[model samples]
Target: MGDALDIMQIAGVGAAALVTEMTRSSWDSMRDAVARFFRRGGEERAEQELRLIDTARQRLVDNPESGRGPVEERLHRALAIQLEAFLQAYPDAAEELQVLTDRIQGTNEGDSGGRTTVHHNSDSQIVIAGGAINASGGFHYRAPEGGR
Candidate 1:
């Protein structure tokens, strides 16, 4: 609506909200809040939008080996379009959007936020809960041809 960058920003915000909220236990409330922001056709419309959110989650879950980069990119495009259209219809929703943004950020800042970690060999990643992350010198190994 505004410009390429502006629309992308709106889309990024939407994507971030979707990413953050889908993991949270209070997902329904978060979904309802976002729906209310658009003030779309009411509760039913909001529920429909929530279905989209669920689809996004499924994409991430179903494509673990596919890497998150490509998945996130696709989501960004879809969410950006949705956000741009929604904002165009309800410019005042920016404040409501901020409310969700702050809440997610605050929630993450507490015990529920993201932490940095790198994992090897296994399918799990090491997560830092409350303290600073630590690392040592790099380690690398070459699998012996057909050996371990």
Candidate 2:
């Protein structure tokens, strides 16, 4: 009888330990899943911003001499401002978007003839240049504040 009681106590403790370990593992997985969810959300926002920038760039290219007197400038400024605001809302993915923006802007500026070619590589880095204005240039990313 004494040996049986000892065996039961040991089994109880082992069972308790297993339950505790299972609970801990479940919590850890939940936490990781939540973190990934937020990360993916931020990435989606960043991609949206990139698309907006690309659209704006295409518009500029299509109507370079549109006599809307400074319309292109205003549009570019608005896009930048809006994108910066978006980045401020999602700092986690801001770095990549910022790098892309800077590269595009630099390429646009260096091209004296307002005609530029853009090349996006598999690595997510883009190169832009006018017919003969191909000096080495690159972009860097910046993060926004308040987790924006």
Candidate 3:
């Protein structure tokens, strides 16, 4: 993550992974560490970012059966912005942030999670997608549950 774009991407992934994969016991500590890393400016911004992470985690925990695409996407985008700003203000921190990013990614990320993916060659090919497909070619997505 030496480059700005790579750093942003890694931070986004690391932030999302930390928020989603961490258990309740380790959550607080990891959140604090993340805040500390981004603590280039005042502590208020770091605290706000951590709070946002917490809120995102709560949403995923509350809706475990539902797809978290929206929450994840939003959190990733927000974290990416924060990371970009921090890196811009402190160019020397790219390597340090990369180390932290590696640590976050190294942790076992639990399951592959669940997703509703469609594959079709043409209108003639119908994807049943969690339910039996009818004769007509149409798309139906049933959210996956309990992790895949």
The clash numbers for all candidates, in the given order, read 0, 3, 0
**lDDT, residue 116, candidate 2:** 51
Candidate 2 lDDT tens digits, 20-85: 222232434433332342354566754664456446545544563545335454564555455345
RMSD of each: 9.5, 26.2, 10.4
TM-scores for all predictions: 0.58, 0.32, 0.56
Clashing pairs in 3: none
Q: Which portions of model 3 show Cα errors greater than 4 Å?
A: 22-25, 109-148
Q: Give the number of the best model, judged by lDDT.
A: 1
Q: Evaluate model 2: give its lDDT.
A: 0.43
Q: Give per-residue CA lDDT, model 3, range 1-148, as digits (tens).
A: 3576776776676666665554456667766677777676568877776676667677766665466667666766766676777777776767767777666655543322336566664434334343234757655555557643
Write model 1 residue lDDT over 1-148, tens digit each, in one string: 3554564575568667677556557777876677666555466766776677678877865776448767877876777677766666666665566667778767767754556656474533344456455558654445458654
Looking at model 2, residue 80 earns an lDDT score of 44
User: Model 1 segments beyond 4 Å from truth?
Assistant: 1-8, 40-44, 112-148
Of the pair 1 and 3, which is ahead by lDDT? 1
**Model 2 C-alpha RMSD to native:** 26.2
